[model samples]
Target chain A: MLYHPLVIFFIEQGVPVQTVLLLLMLPVVATLVAFFRQVVGIKAFGIYTPSLITFALLAFDPNGLKYGITIFVSVILVGMVTRFILNRFRLLYLPRVAITLSIVSLTILLILVTGGMYQRTGLASVSIFPLLIMITLAEKFVATQIEKGSRAAFILAAETLVISIVGYFLVSWQTLTVLILEYPWIILFTFVINFSLGKWTGLRITEYFRFRKIARHL
Target chain B: MFEFFKKSQGFLGMNSRNLEYIRPNNRKRGMEIADSKLLCKRILKKNNLGVSTLIAKIKNYEELDQFDFSTLPDSFALKPNRGFGGEGIIVVYARKKLARNTTDENKNNVWIKANGSTITAEDLKSHIRNIIDGSFSLSSVPDIAFFEERLKLLKLFKPYSYKGIPDIRIIIFNRVPVMAMLRLPTRASDGKANLQQGAIGVGIDLATGTTTTAILGKGHLIEYIPGTRLALSGIKIPYWKNILRMSIDAQSVSHLGFLGADIAIDRDRGPVILELNARPGLSIQLANSSGLKERLKRISGLKIKTTERGMRVGMNLFGGEIEEEIEEISGKRVIGSVEKIKLIGKDGREIEVEAKIDTGADSTSIDIELAKQLGFGDALKTFEEKVGGRDVLTELSKEEREKLFSSIPDLADTVPIKSSHGYSYRPIVLTTLIIDSIPIPAKVSCIDRSHLSYPVIIGRKHLRKFLIDINK
Candidate 1:
């Protein structure tokens, strides 16, 4: 079997609820958007790879919460190290994203391989391949650092992750899941929403900083 | 109906909708922000939270066309100060055609757009039409539209955003940030986060203060640039928690029951509160995807001391381990759509037998039958809803409503469905109707809910018009 029998068995059980899929996939999509549309200065990898990897592992061990935490922690640790490495090597941003993705992919691969050996499951090991996305991210981060400098690039990456995590939880939510599941196309409203925002030439709530003093002065 | 075909949306093993549940700890102290923008500004200024700058406020409709739309700055937003949503706001970038006020000899007096479109006289007239229709104010109480300066954009997001800067939507219950999402302006969004338009909603993780997910325009999930894959999960937001604190502070300042604080990031200025929304949007719920009703119910009785203290409590309460668990528990998430209800007279509320769900009625009205069933009907004589009934003859407050109601004689509080001849005023009774599951109860002006299309009109008289979902 591609995966351990148990992993396959879980799939057979139809274990992942619609809500679970919702939570798992949201961050990936959000991250993708922040990069392309908003041009948030984050990584730009092919969208499918990372998204698929994340979702496939969604039906992993029942201790999903713990596992998710562990993965996040690992990714962060890897991300920092990847940052230091790319910086030290002076890798360009796109290459840095690629290298970061490579390093992350390698680590995930090693872990999965060793894990497969321990569990006698081939597919389980390959399941972690989405690490390539991090590799892609590394490339983007490196490029951003080169172009926008470390601080701004880092800010972009940080916000991207923050938005993604938020997206993860939101998309993962049950009520949200059910609602969107029913009206998934409501996403189309995004077009109309963008139209509304297009007309919003007013000061942002955050603009109070520069404007507040002006407000006080006025 | 379309939702049924959503099954194939399962592309590459990911969830189609990003639905993050809000945890209990993240919820802040509850503050009932008043609906009045002028009132809210007074409170916000005293509390030091940011709100829109007001140039002047006109009270009636007579002075509408006479007011100088020209004396304003080259760039200013004409807004219905009390308007909720994005309605009734006229932002004049530059002047259009040569009016009588301009130099008569200067042959070409055409105002141009960033895109080079000429602003003709008819354009401004159409805008005025929206204003005259009371499109901006909360209620059609003829309001004055005022002008405010435009916010400058932050350098970091220049490329990503269109002409308009972006805003962050933070939902603070009490004083804590339960959930937050960044609303980015695109060519499609027209530079506004009003999801009713087409702006991108990027979910933010409270724990990390970074962007977690990105949604193009609305619900469709895309990864990378429309053509690229940019991992969107880690863009960090500056002064993250401070924004939550500001929204919460604004609540206390405004006394709004519930609020959606719109904050924006400016390069030199940092974070500012753009507008305080008493009734925010429902997309926040869809964006965050967790029901806020139950969470709001839990903290309904929280004893908050001050806005700052409440903010701190909200941070600690919602920031810790509980968030993840809440994400696991209810998966209730959404960014905005707020309403503040006063649950008084609910000291000993009774369980509702059969309630009607009507989006048509902005507010919820109880039937005299239900009010009596809940043990409060006799106390309702001079109340509002009861007076609408034909036989009740309750005193009327507004000459307009009275005139309107009198003319429609069929407009009884409780007209029987399929009743001909309009004699179907079941009975008008006054009592407090309890909110289905919420702690707040209205000393509801009621009527015989029986025989009406939906029992109670749940009229705007009752509901302050918070966008809602019965199932949620």
Candidate 2:
């Protein structure tokens, strides 16, 4: 296949075939997130955040469930506290967000230092990418909290975590990863799936529940 | 059986909707036009269609600063041009009368909402700012805020509608109006006639323009208006035929093969187009308790020559059977084993009789003696002379039969009744009977029912408008 030449060239450049394959899987994960939102009717922290979290979790460790959740919950908590406190100051938007980011970074640094002292390598050795992704999620979480209130923010945060977990599990499946690596063309099918889903203007599965009263009339 | 039919027929899922209706019917340009309230208003007005007149529009921050609130009318609707669904729309029912004691800073007036709640001018300005900032647009893109004339509630819908004006949503496909639903605002929906926001959706008959079964938010089947005994169905919508014609015309002019025309009926103006939706929702199917797929398929490839032809075809094809629809709407069960029927005589004397329900018989038969007692004695005597009595009538030749039947000018009709004892020919007459308190003109055949327990027997012909429940 003509695509094999490009695959060989990437391998020759010292990039492992699995890493290249994982990069290609990002679109598939993104499409799944979109499906959950558009068709399944699960509103989360948009598409990119959940997909990034899923990718980070998958790439960090095969079984980084413990560390992944710790980082996720910690980021949300720090972000919420910083936002609640900062809200009273009524500072300008950019400066307030910058301060919140610095605080979130400091909190992550503290966790890393504490984990190293306890010799918990899993927490101490966690990559900066997932940490940064969680910080970005925190920004969204706090903003939503301020805009739509805590209840909506909490629901969206929980839904985002659920979607991320689902995406992480999907990417972690060894057989699925091997299959995608062997046939990179499969990534193109996500476009097909998304195209079909894009045309879907029907009631979301969640809408069925939302409109359960109307469904009962049937 | 009903459950299976409902599962198979009534609901149209999301996939079938986009692939079939939206994708093929709605064009990108058409959707853009439909999405922007200003564009829709312009197009509809250019087409000479009735629309709520625009009072003022603020396009940018500069316009917002220069805009004067005092020049506005006492009642108007403030809305975002790109607002999706029912969001970013604030309808002010009326303005509060200014008091003499109010100071300069407090000079800003208060406005009353449809629900009788008051909002200050500051709140209105903030809402308009949010609208201009694109808070309600589909993608949160910057939008234009505008004011429109607030439509008055039609008298017919005053009882049904709460604070908000009720609107009719007509789903048209291929220039044919496939289905329609009347959206009535509820307290739960905050006086907005958006179904997703918890308003009531009542199915309307395409032909007669009358309401049938109604479904509340989600899909609860409701028989009457909430908090009242007044049944939701059987409301003969005013200017129904005009509404259908206008919906089809809007679809034709917009060139959206599949469209949902939201039309509001003003107290004086009748129906004015509120907005056009390229991607109309499928909940209308549940409101009608009928499937859109079937209705769409029925009109799929038909060559509709003109807007009038399409509407006529839609009315003929989708128009429900009036009698059956009325029975469903009125929630009245058909008469069964026996019913108290009032028989009006030729002399205008009325007598109540227990009528036997017999679907096997073709026409109603009244006893000869009972007919005479009801002041039909002279007619019966003349019929006997013309037909040589009931006994000889069955024995008459074809020529004799025709001659005898033609000679009796008062004879409304003739029917042959075969009983265990013998067969006989009877003369029918036009009579009025009150069944189930609904007065109806019926064809009554005069027969010798002396042996029968019930003097009057209602046949299948007279029971066309009823359901015969043997148990009842």
TM-score to native of every candidate shown: 0.39, 0.70
State the RMSD for candidate 1: 26.2
Instruction: For candidate 1, write residues B305-390 as lDDT tens digits.
Output: 77677666655543433234444565532112222222223235544334444556555565565555554444443333543334
Interface RMSD of each: 23.3, 5.3
True contacts kept of each: 0.00, 0.25
Pick out the ten consecutive residues of candidate 2 chain B with the lowest summed lDDT: B1-10
Query: All candidates' lDDT scores?
Result: 0.50, 0.80
Candidate 2 Cα lDDT to native? 0.80
lDDT per residue, candidate 1, A77-188, as tens digits?
Answer: 5766777765555333345556666676677666667767888454343333333444455545554544334555656665555444444454456675555445454556
Instruction: For all candidates, state DockQ relative to the true structure.
Output: 0.02, 0.28
- Give every collision pair in model 2: A202-B14, A213-B218, A213-B219, A213-B220, A214-B218, A214-B219
* CAPRI grade of model 1: incorrect
The model with the greatest lDDT is 2
Per-residue error at B466 for model 1, in Å? Answer: 46
Best by TM-score: 2
